[model samples]
Target: MRQHGLLTLGAGLCAAAALGLAAPHPALAAPDSCSYTSPTHQPTLTHGDTGAAVKQAQCLSNMWGGEPPKLPLDGVFDSVMLKKIKWIQGCHGLPQNGVIKDRTWQVLYHPALDCYDPYPV
Candidate 1:
């Protein structure tokens, strides 16, 4: 058996067709999987670092998905993460030192849609 009278909607009928029944709301956008922290609070992260900050960097780095593959989000800055960081840095014309500092943070947060430099094999 099933209930029928329990189907109550919005108090103001807000759940109209505009809510995707007929068309998608133009202003709505789903958030991505990554989003580890506020951009302003990014710490100076380097290899061997671990914790939320490292996780943040890893998450953001995954946003730049390319040749190397997405990181594990384990918060450990291993050699693989280092190479990816260097590639991202190089793409932004920053020094490819494999250090996730201020400028690197900027790129990680706002990565270019396309990178001219190919990911190294």
Candidate 2:
């Protein structure tokens, strides 16, 4: 299996070189439901933050559903959002800190299909 993977990787690299490319570009997260600025450009959000970005984060987090209860989408980062964020971080194997940093944002945009951790109370 390792040898096959290595061969595949080598073939991919050779193909990329032949095509005059560095490597394959990864797929970007799907279009989000919110109309706010693209999530990639939004600033980090944490406790006490509020605005379109917060609304955007809330909306994305809601997609996780039972991983954490859905948020209000009210553009306010309150306790509920904090708790939900922490659970989401845990599900993604990220720091359990409830801050919406870059990695957190990425996970929010692209959550796992199914989290292995049991839902938080």
Candidate 3:
């Protein structure tokens, strides 16, 4: 009787192992959906006057999903825009200072750095 019980337990263990091997874990499965992609590609701001900064802001706005929150892109560093950019930086897991630092630019423009595909259209 004991021998029969041992055999049954071994068979159950084998079946469980087989089932585990046959199916993928739920965590490894793909997500149900994702968001739309952005349009613009890597954008370089001229950085000398307000116009350049504005242009950068526009490009950033497009990348984000709307117009940039009115930042002076020509290197003037508008306070409002700076706060907004800081928010963006926070989202991107960077320093939140509202300044367009080089690291922030890398995350914003060159997402992949080597061959980034600037979000979606």
Candidate 4:
């Protein structure tokens, strides 16, 4: 798994300033309904799990843009989904085990656009 370095605070601020975008304030980033509605009590999904929950996870992952591009919203948790989930987990500093736990679901619904960490697939 190749890990990429996170952007420094100064660099992030500079980029936001240069782009004329407001730097996101930690306190102002509110949790939205998307996170609330996403799957919470479903069993941990891994390779070969198929159903609505898997499809929902895939759909939410599209909101989380990153390497490997957007995935097809199929109702199967295959290898591709596993790789993407692991990547997202690593990006959010969670255990990169490809398991769709509660925290993983939260990150899927609300993602950072500038995830510097490279997902080691």
lDDT of each: 0.68, 0.71, 0.41, 0.66
List model 2 lDDT by residue over 1-121, tens digit each. 9999889877866665565433211222233565565766758788999898898888777766443346776899998899888877887789999999898988877777545354466
TM-score preference between candidates 2 and 4, better one: 2
Query: Candidate 1 at residue 87, lDDT?
Result: 83
Q: How would you order the candidates by lDDT, starting with the best?
A: 2, 1, 4, 3
TM for candidate 3 is 0.38
Q: Give per-residue CA lDDT, model 1, range 1-121, as digits (tens).
A: 1333234433222343233222111122112445566656778888999988898888777766444556788989999999889988887899999988889987776776435455656
TM-score of 2: 0.69
- Give the backbone clash total of model 3: 7
Candidate 2 ranges with C-alpha deviation above 4 Å: 1-31
Residue pairs with clashing backbones, model 3: 37-120, 38-120, 49-74, 50-74, 53-73, 53-74, 54-73
lDDT of 3: 0.41
Candidate 4: residue 116 Cα off by (Å): 1.5
TM-score of each: 0.69, 0.69, 0.38, 0.63
lDDT of 4: 0.66
Q: What C-alpha RMSD separates each model from the true structure? A: 13.4, 11.5, 17.5, 8.9
- lDDT, candidate 3, 22-71, per-residue tens: 21112221112111222232233333325443445434433432123233
Off by over 4 Å in 1: 1-33
